[model samples]
Target: MESIDRRLVHALQIDGRAPFAKIAGVLGISEHTAARRYQRLKERGIRVRGALNRFRLGHHAWTLRLRCTPDAGPALAQALARRDDTFWVHLMSGGTEISCLQQVKNPDELLLDRLPRRLVDVSAHNVLRGFASPGTWRGLACLEPDEVAALRPEFEPEPPTELTPLDEALLGTLEVDGRAGYADLAATTRTSESTARRRVEHLRRTGVLELRLDADPSRFGFATQARLWMRVEPRSLAAVGVTLATHSEVYFAAATTGPANLVASVTCRSGGDLYRYLTERIGSLDGVRETETAPVLRTLKRVALSEGEAFPCHA
Candidate 1:
């Protein structure tokens, strides 16, 4: 990717709904050039999609780590991906482990007690707090400081909003294309364009809706991805999590229940890159007592739905 293209990706990460003209202005390029570059990037599997932050609406999220028989790992990963309740399904630790994030209001939805065939072990950790995610990751950053400020999303206090059927329908279209125009959104949700636009704003204001940029980290040269599960001293847990959230290599960091108090997802350029990060960065952090690194051998599902390409090897 060219410098301008990377800038565009960075801009979208900040505000997925940012206008192409606005992006072009920040990059000091023609609007058409910026739009064209984005289209090219889209062709390369980059996308901005709508997402629902159910956690903000009193929903609980759990991260599951499943260690299965080698032969069952791939099949189990796919089975989990086929369900709408699961996301971020990964094959890791020599293709014998599967990790996924799931949100369910009903405990029965988890079904952990009834392990599927060939499964050896399963552990589910309740996500207590989150410090970072792809939306907050700065690994793809390329814009100058001023340019970043120009694209930052505004924040303001808002009252709690109820989720209506119309809002759910509207979210359906956005999940496929976050940049869908008001007219297209209206057509899908069977409402006026003005109504569609207002509803989107309301959802965003109330923290129920989010527009996220989805792309392969390897496409931007950060190829190696791994999950770092660390046990931190109780008092410094928040401090360590806050620090890890800012690390360029980390895309997801959160505090969770279970043996490890903290977990982080990171991407690096190579094995040496990861080694240096673990030694120089994590090693130097206070209160980090023990760390277990699980390299992601394949990502079967991202935050959203499965990809169009042939499945089985990704991330």
Candidate 2:
């Protein structure tokens, strides 16, 4: 995309409600051009939507790293990509491990109970803590306007899903800005503010939509994030898993089939916090036989759609 388009994307990532006129002004383009560019981007499988800070909303988000056989890599990855429960999946470096994110109503117990049964060679962890930031398109942000325009035809989007008209419209508005006002949503959905509010409530109740604050880990003082892996006897899994899940510092956890039966992603405000969690929290847990850790140095792709008007796992 053009530098102007990148600027527009950045603006939207910061505030999805940024008016087209403002984006155009910032990019020295016309509002119509800005609008067209955004529509085009959406057509190209680039999602511009509201990302909920689910944790703040009383839901827990966990990243699960899978260690599967090389032969099973593609198969497992594809299976996960097609599952609605998995928010994102990636073949890690060397393709030996796959990383994924799961948004669960609760992260502690179910995460552990579900993994061994979910995939053949899955290793699990409730990441004690980790850092996260809203994904931006700066990398894909360099497309020129002409490039974006030229690519429009090839970028034809899949038709919207078979949702109610209101559901379809609400998804569109929320895709543009998760934090949009009820009045704004009403205008977009062609419904009254009260109706829009009711629609949003319904979406939430049905688990189709989640709204939350998106935080940047570095900005939040979690410069170092690591998934702490632990091995526990099957009998101790439940008691230990529940304890770790409810701990504020433990962001996500799950059970796996590997040596480290339990895995956790952890975040700390400082090095001191990290030291305390490992020495105090983790070390204190019984039935943990051995432990291993992998620090997430960088994350390439965060999440994707299993279905809908978003990025489909199929090519």
Candidate 3:
């Protein structure tokens, strides 16, 4: 990708709905160049979509790791990917391990029991908190502070509201196309255009929905990505988590139930960068007892929403 393309992606990461003209103005480029670059990136399978903030909507988010026999790994991973509850499925540790993210309102005891017996081991971690997400990470550090500031969306905290069926329908549509037109949303939900607009706005105000730009970090120069699991002393869990959250490389970090009390996903420019992060940054943190790292080989799914052409490569 060209430098301008990286900048464009960064700007969109800040505000997925920012107009091409606005982006061009911020990047000091012609509107045509900005639009053309975005079109090219989209053609290459890069996408920006709206994602639901399930935690904000009073849902619990959990990351499940399944270890299967080599013969059963791929099929089992695909099965989990097909489920409505699993949003992300990844093949790790040479395809014998699968990691996925799922969200639920009330913990269902039968949920795990229903899994196919083909799996050998299964572990689930509730994502108690997040330090960074795609929506928050500024990739490649390409955009200027002023440009980023100009593109940032003004978020007005809305009081929590109940999500009606109509609200779910609207969220589902937006999850596919964060920039979907109100007419399209209205048509999908069988509601008036004005009602569709009002409902979407309400969801956003209430923090039930979020629009995010999903792209391949490798395409923009960050070629290595890894998931980190760390065990921190109980007294320092909060402090360690807060500190980890402040790092730019940390994408999603949360407290979980497993032996490893904390899990984090990080993207870096190369193997050397990853080493520095582990040895210098993470190694410096006090109270962190143990750490394990897994390189993500393939990402079958991206967000907590249903599967679709929401990402560029997967789409």
Candidate 4:
């Protein structure tokens, strides 16, 4: 069994709608205990919310990569941090290049399309066909120095095993359309409504699926977007990564191979807001060595798992 906190997080991850009483029964604890633990978890930044389906919400998505001047790394990072489409941002060794997750309504709005007119001496690589993580895979990475602090290590929870084919299809549909109804899913999967509902519950119970509404950021007033890349001292990565992940503007964070050792996706309401986040929040983090930024053009897809494919291909 998962630790109390992890168990609660896992329960919420599977189905944010699960009542405290149900979780209490599963963990053999009082409902009050479950509620108190949940409150504490949220205070510590352990979010247990539903995932969003960007496509269903009517927005375009894409990823963008950039090559920058080493001297401009910090400035570029600050610039990208201020946009809504920019989901993550980072600065690499000496700040020569940056990459980020970007989204736009149509091809014409791509930041890359306007880069030549806006910024000089920069190169880009745009991934037209790729997916993002369908679930929240990023958590604080453990560091050696962190062992000194009283940091409570959060164990990675176990993923559910053995989903039925019907379960898989229902999950696949919801991955793209979180609001899909039980009756509609039942019709598509050729099952009774009650059966479909049961399978959904099972999938949710076993941590195999999540069903929730995710809206496009633009619709909510966040308009600017970009991808930022950063290079930090290897020893300081854990602290730096955790700091970036906690930012309200940051949507995604992960370690990657490159001079810019870390990557992040950030969204903002305006260019001014993006700039303020980078200079005030990101630049203020300790152990950060340098950074880079790349504004995104258009997002083709945001990591929909319906394709059932794994990333970082292996032979």
Candidate 5:
């Protein structure tokens, strides 16, 4: 990708719904140029989708690691991807291990009474908290500080606002296309344009809706992507998670309950790059006692939701 494209992506990462004029001003391009570039990029696989803030809505998010039979992995992963609940699903360790992340209102649904009787084992980790996510990762941030500041959205801290059924219907459209026009959104929800616009703004200000840009790391020259499951000293887990999230290679990091307390998803340019990261970046961390690296062979789902998928701002 060119520097201008990276700048545009970075601006969107800061605020996905930023006006074309705002993006153009920051990138020193005309609004029409900015719009054209974005459309082209979208066609080339740069996607934006709206997601509900699960933690903010008092929902429990869990990451599951499944060790499956060699033949069952791909089909099982596809099945999981097609579901509205499972957002991130990856086939790792040469398609023998599956990593999935889903949000649930009741932790009991996943934690107990549900274990597929297949080959091997399964582990479920409840995300205690997230240090970094797609929205916060700045690894792709190429814009200058002032440029980023100019594009960042400003909103006061808001109390959690519950969503109505109509809001869920509206989000159904955004889950597929975050940049959908207000007219389209209103039509999908069968409401007036003014009502739809007002509701979306309210959701944004309240921290209920997050616009996530879905661009594969490989597109940006990071060919090697892996999940780092680190067993850290309990006392230093928080610090280690926070520090790892700041690294350029790490796109996702969180502290969770289970054997491996800290987990991160990292992308590097090559095998050599990954080795350097493990030996230099991760090795230097005093808290990370043992590290297990699971190379992500394929990602079947990411924030991908079908057009009719119902998010309801709950998960």
Candidate 6:
């Protein structure tokens, strides 16, 4: 991608709903150019979608890693990907391992018991807290601090409210397209345009939903992506997690349960860059005792709002 295109993507990452004129002004390009570039990128499957913030909704999140026989990995991963609760399904370290994120109100024993018999090992780390997520990562370092601040939305917290069936229906539409116009939202939810607008605003103010631009890192010159699992001293876990979260290379960082108490996803220009990060950055952290890195071979499914749909699972 051209430098301007990259900057445009960064702008969208900061605010997916940023006006074309605003993005053009930030990138020192004409509004026409910005609009055209965005159209091209969207044609390639780079898109922004509204997603639920599970934490804000009081739901528990988990990082699930499954090691399976080579032949069974893809099928198992796909099965998980098809479920509404699972997101970020990935094939890592070749095709024998699967990694995914899931959010739910409570543990589902029935879901766990349905795992494929061919699985060799399975680990589900409860994500106690997140220091960074797609919405928070500063991966595109092209913009100035002021430029970034200009694109950010003014946040005003709202009181928590139970999600009504109408709200869920509205969310389902937004999940597919965050930039959907008020008319579209109103039509989908079968309500007045003013009512739809007010409800969506309330959801955003309360932090129950977030809109994020999802794009492949490789498209922005980041060719290597890896997942880092680190065992940190319990006392220093918060410090280490916070530190990792501040790095531009770190996309997702969270404190999790199990032996590897913290897990982070990082993107870099190459293997050498990843090595430097692990050695110079993470290795120097005070509480990091051991680290294991897994290269993401391919992503079968990326982040999406839970559709809350049910599917048959292997028992």
Find the 10 residues in a row with the least total lDDT in model 2. Answer: 306-315
Q: Score residue 38 of candidate 5 by CA lDDT.
A: 94
Tens digits of per-residue lDDT, candidate 5, 15-98, equal 888889989998999999999999989998887788766556777778889999888899888878887667678899998999
Q: What does candidate 1 score on TM? A: 0.93
Question: What's every prediction's RMSD, in angstroms?
Answer: 4.4, 12.8, 4.3, 12.2, 3.2, 4.8
User: Judged by TM-score relative to the true structure, which candidate is superior, 2 or 3?
Assistant: 3
Query: Which candidate, 4 or 6, would have the higher TM-score against the true structure?
Result: 6
Q: Give the clash count for model 1.
A: 0
Write candidate 2's Cα lDDT for 1-315 as tens digits.
466655565555544445677667656789999888877656654444543333433455555677766666666666666654455455643555677766566656344454433344554444333322223212223445653443222222232223478976786667455647789889887899999987666665443454322332443346765666678888997677667755655544655545676666565666787788888888898888777765554333333232111111111
Q: How accurate is candidate 2 locally (lDDT)?
A: 0.55
Off by over 4 Å in 2: 108-121, 128-130, 136-194, 197-315
Runs in model 5 deviating more than 4 A are 111-115, 306-315
Of the two candidates 5 and 6, the one with more favorable lDDT, higher being better, is: 5
| Residue 259, candidate 4: alpha-carbon lDDT | 67
The TM-score, computed over Cα atoms with residue i paired to residue i, of candidate 5 is: 0.94
The parts of candidate 4 lying over 4 Å away from their true place are: 1-159, 303-315
Off by over 4 Å in 6: 305-315
User: Could you tell me how far off, in angstroms, the CA of residue 282 lies in candidate 2 after the best superposition?
Assistant: 25
Better structure of 1 and 4 per TM-score: 1
* Pairs in clash, predicted candidate 5: none
Please give the TM-score that candidate 6 achieves against the real structure. 0.92
Clashes of each: 0, 29, 2, 38, 0, 0
Q: Rank the candidates by lDDT, best first.
A: 1, 5, 6, 3, 2, 4
